[model samples]
Target chain A: MTAHASPIGPGPTGPGPTAPPPAPPAVSPLRLVATLGISGALAGLLLVSVHRVTEPVIAAHKQRVLEDAVLEVLAGPTSYRTLYLVDGAFTPDLPAGADPRTLDTVYAGLGDDGARLDGFAIPASKPGFQDKVSLLFGWEPKDGTVRAIRVLESRETPGLGDRIEKDPAFAAGFVGRTTPLVGVKAGRGTGAPSEVDMITGATISSRTVIDAIDTTLARLRPALDAYAAEAAR
Target chain B: MKETTAREDLLRGIWRENPVLVQMLGLCPTLAVTNSVANSLAMGIATAFVLLGSSVLVASVKRLVPGEVRISAYVLIIATFVTVADMALEALAPGIHKALGAFIALIVVNCIILGRQEAFASKRPVGRAALDALGTGAGFVIALVLMGSVREVLGSGSFLGHPLFGAHYEPWVVMILPPGGFLTLGSILIALSWLRRRRAAAAGEARS
Candidate 1:
């Protein structure tokens, strides 16, 4: 195969008063292949080294952040346990042959007694105004109200759609609100049990948060109920 | 081309050829992550690390690379450094890493790093390349912080999460949104051009 000449070198010059530019040096195919191969190898080596060095630290950091989010959304529970959804049931153990990464897991925040359930911190995500909005919300099964919410990840439009995660009023509206919440115009909630005050300019993002929680709860509430009953027994 | 001194190489990117404001390179991260001061600072440092590392490596290996594959080689080198920076940021400062989000990984595609490698690092000596990287990195950081300060102060009524105004301050919400980035950058560019023109006129009058 003919070697592709470097574009950086001068192109073929037509005869002119100025002496024609010297012919570009021929690049050997082997050398070109070796250059790319060595670069690829070096890149692979560097990335591998960095990944090894940072893997544990990143994992620990993620775990810590997840724990903090769980606690914040669950309203400062003494501790929390990971419950995997298996066959429509919440079990503390991972299901056979199921990847933990792909499995749907919820955190059951425990009260001081270690056995009392404070609430369930359910993590959910849905496409928002700009990107997917991931959040964790504390669900009180007994009262059927959301306790609190923490936006774990979101790329909503800053200062506007991002108010879903930043605005205190928007978050406060979710606290103690009934399940399957309804999004209303900002400050137009009639103090109804299921009404949520959406950010004025971020209706899509606000609705996305509600939809994420409501859909997850709708799919998991039956299993959650079973799990709660099993725990009670 | 006139040969540049080390000091000139180190200082040019800060104002004369700034990667963000003056040259208008790397605007993706500039606009996306500059809504808050902390995020802007974190991204600037991360990008700086990648640029510096890639430039140094590219300069060192310039001879080894054939012209046919120079761009590919530079991209590989850049991607490596970007990955290293991304991993380091996630490990050392996960909160900032999270806030920066996909922008960290997206640094591999940032034109500033590659443009420097092709335009300066591949041709210059290692020391010169390093100086250029530092200058460009500093410029990028300065531009990001300037944008961040404006957006955060006006959009959120705070600076780095601290409220600059009293409780009554009403935030200009649009200032932190995407449009805010364009508006802020446009205003800064206009002001910079105006200042430059005024300085040029004064210099011309004195010379006359």
Candidate 2:
């Protein structure tokens, strides 16, 4: 049997152009797997390294913003101290009754000498028309009222609900208001002492803030009163 | 005295191929955050930072990325830069960060970043890719500012939060809402098309 008469056709292993292009030297399955694995590992390492570099700076910046928010809500305090609430009482240290997951952080603003109390800035949140309206509200027990309020986070409607932050009159109305705050229409007289004038187009957002302050204060009043008694001692 | 090709590459995005006006790539942010100048500027800067960083990274590592898996690799790289930008913005400028909110996080999915990566960066050198990304970013910012200014001035009678009109100037409430974004963009697109038609007509007249 000559070579041409063989049962099987000739498999041309030569570098001829017509030889099915040599199968383009297909990448081995192992090589493909290794390449993908290395690429993913490198990407992960890069992300981890970046996270490491930025983590501390980000944390520090957030702390600074929070501190600033405390001062802002308190109308610019000289110094501040963070207190934790547990079992209807405020304490310097985290209390045993305080749920680690939902512990309420209360910031005590101190005067220039750091002895006299300026006010307390407490964060609160409530659902608005669109989403949660997170805020920091300042309270002074001496006045039996809220000192000021600063929006910490809000996803209110752009032109309407956001007016809670944008409108000066609406924000100013929050200051010096008593607990159990109420939100009313802009032109409608705040018939009661604890009422806030809602932004013209942002009744829901305004009510969200007022209701949040009222609810948060109702929950914290006992702790604040207890703290006041402890201070008197 | 001029480098024509480089200049063309840089300026092309501004008018000829604006990511917003002409190309219409990143309309999600273009429409969503253009309510006020402040928000639009913040979003633009954040998006630009992500785009520029991702373009450079993708260009540098393009060769290593396998063709079949390149899209995934590019997306991962883009997401990494976007997260870094978002974190940096939140830490450095919390107010603007808050105002920008999820839009900052949404930069990861902005087609402008991914488009640049898939179309230009992966095929070019790092320097060129970065320049292209910068041009595109600047164009995006300009477009955002235009929309923002129109919306803010008309809707709120303010520019950059400062009152631009007198007390008697009644704000057009629609300009600042979602519809206002569409209106402003639509007007801008119409104006652009008109100008283009005029230019084309003039060129045709000259040829005739």
Candidate 3:
């Protein structure tokens, strides 16, 4: 009976040895680290590849959009050249510019032949009702008057402040407007080249654009005049 | 009976478990970008692309990931696709890109895509995962377009930028504002719930 019991016990226990033991309670440090590292590396590789492939395309598209804006403001120039403002002076490249760089960009519109100077498209930015109001406007240096204006970027309110771009009548007021610009209430009579009728609701945003254009034009007028003369000669 | 048919898996997200209306995920962009139809369309397409790509990639690689770092892994994968989508949109459609602005980059944090990766895609085969992603994405698009149409038509008195009302018609100015998003969504939810209740009652009567 004892021998039989022993044989039975051993037979029952034999199957347990063949069955797989439970996995370790925790993942080994090496395996965990390796897994994370591999996942990270794969993700990094994918991002890098996408960035590399799309970088040039994105840059080119941005350049094209800016060019289109310039054309619209400058009344359809055939070509344009970007000049940079560095340390109170203009330069074509950044390497040769001074350390305290303003890096302001001015686009000089060229005529159909691409040789004669047409006008200048200068970008300007200033605080608005909500945020920064940045825009590009064409300058006819001969008359020292703004040809046209297009908002490049703005973060004003949707219905009111956003009227700066949405209201074509308001934007139309900028065409042929002279500098030292001032914004008054809409529907007010336009008696002066410097006076502009602000949007009915968006006084601050309208004022922001008018003031920014005025200040920027005032500062850059001399340099712009000199550049235009040089290009014409 | 526990697992659904492939067709059901493909169709479920469109209505039964919609990412936006039913699941109530990814509302930030829904409210922000649906101010206009064009913006809504662009945002929806961009989101769909990101969702589909991330789901497929995650489904294919689910087994290799350890449970401990799975969330981080999923985020890393999702972020990669978001970056790709952002760059692709910027390159291909600059106007849309400019209109959508940072919301395109914000797609990475959209809970719907990450939720799918964690809950459904990680457990399913790649084919089924993709189908689910597509359904969910289509549902999101439908919801956005619905809201966009309503807002654009009522707020601006236009449909997709075309004037639907005469000059004398005054638009509901509140419809284009942020509060309008909340009001429209609330009304839609109420209407959907009412329809659902009516259907349930009819089904119960039939069973009786």
Candidate 4:
């Protein structure tokens, strides 16, 4: 087979063909298999080596990011522990044979005394304008209000819908807001305990954030209340 | 096979045949990540690394592969390099990696890297292939940065992350959005063609 010419290049400039090129020799199947096998093996070896080297680093980076987000939402908790919900109850330890990734989990933060419960940083995600928007918010059971919020992941439209994450004003509006939060027009928030001003051009995305929190709280509030009561006891 | 000088191979992709601006290859990543200068630079460097590494490997192993499996072999090599780039970026520069997101993995399918392996690297010596890859990589970087600068300044009223026009400047929000990418790229293409035509006209006038 003739070599495929690239249109990106200045077309073939080989020495002026004095005559037509000679017919190419046929290739054997054995050589083709050998070539592919060798290539695959080499590729595998390179990937394995790189993966081994970077796996720990990538894991550490992810761990740090999660910890930082949790701490930020929880307002500098002295310590935090992962709690998994299984069979209608929250457990501090992972259940046998259950992947931590697939289970509902929250990070419970402790105050400076290391024994007093500060609050919980709960992560939730829901469909937004472009893709799923994932976020973490601190829920204070004492006051039954959202303490702080941070957007962990989002693919919203930049400079518009993305303001749900990038705009501090929008994020601040969620702080100290009660459940069943109401989204009002921008600059029209009545300063009520549960009122949040939606971003001007990102009403849907803004609402998605509120809805995700509300849905998550509705599903997990009973379990959280039980956990809080047990801790109080 | 054509005999390309080292200089020609090194310089061709930069201006005469830029991968993004001139040839329009890899436009997906070009448009997706060029909203900010930092993201654009990270993407450019990552793509350049993959292209250069794959070109060298393909050139070194050109003789061993039969024509029937050349494409597969090249893809395997390119994918390996892309994976390595992805891992390294995630570990070393997590922020940039997060900003780039799926575009880094999408580099595996970029036509520019595979196109070079098929056309230039497979047919040329190792040195020539390396030079060509560097040239193409540089061209890609320049085009991305150019688009990024225009979009960031107009879209956010900032260059990089620093505000350029103070607080009063009202950013043309459309410049940084999806439409901004296309608008900036189209404007650049128009400007490039206009420049080329002007140069051609000048040359014609001199000749006449």
Q: Considering every candidate listed, which one attains the maximal lDDT?
A: 4
In order of DockQ, best first, we have 4, 1, 3, 2
CA lDDT of every candidate: 0.86, 0.78, 0.80, 0.87
Q: How many backbone overlaps does candidate 4 show? A: 0
| Residue range B57-146, candidate 2, lDDT tens digits | 888977666666667777777777777787777767777887777888788778777767766777667887788888899999999999
Q: Could you give me the TM-score of model 2 versus the true structure?
A: 0.76
Q: What residue pairs are clashing in model 4? A: none
Please report how far candidate 3 places residue B42 from its true position, in Å: 2.6
Candidate that beats the other on DockQ, 2 or 4, i.e. the better one: 4
Flag the better candidate by TM-score, 1 or 4. 4
Q: Write the per-residue lDDT of candidate 2 for residues A1-233, one digit (tens) a residue.
A: 11121122223211112211112245666765776687678767877887888788878887887887888888868688888876567777876665755888898888887866778898999998877888998898775688888887776776678878776677788888888887778678747888778888777888889999989988888888777666656
* Candidate 4 chain B minimal-lDDT segment of 10 residues: B1-10
Candidate 4 residue spans exceeding 4 A from truth: A1-28, A113-116, A157-160, A186-192
Which tens-of-lDDT digit does each residue in A1-233 have in candidate 3? 01111231212211012222233468777877898899889888988898899999999887778889998899878798777776555555665534533467788888889868889899999998767988999989898778889987887876788889778888899888878777888768568887788988788899899988989988987788777777778
Return the clash pairs for model 3, or none. Answer: none
User: Distance (Å) between predicted and true CA of A36, model 1?
Assistant: 2.6
Ranking by lDDT: 4, 1, 3, 2
lDDT of 4 by residue, B87-157 (tens): 99999999999889999999988888887887778777899889999999999999899999999999888
Each candidate's chain B TM-score?
0.96, 0.94, 0.94, 0.96
Best by TM-score: 4
TM-score of 1: 0.82
Which portions of model 2 show Cα errors greater than 4 Å? A1-25, A28-60, A72-77, A86-91, A94-101, A109-119, A141-144, A154-163, A166-177, A182-205, B1-8, B161-163, B166-168, B198-208
Rate residue A221 of model 1 by lDDT. 94
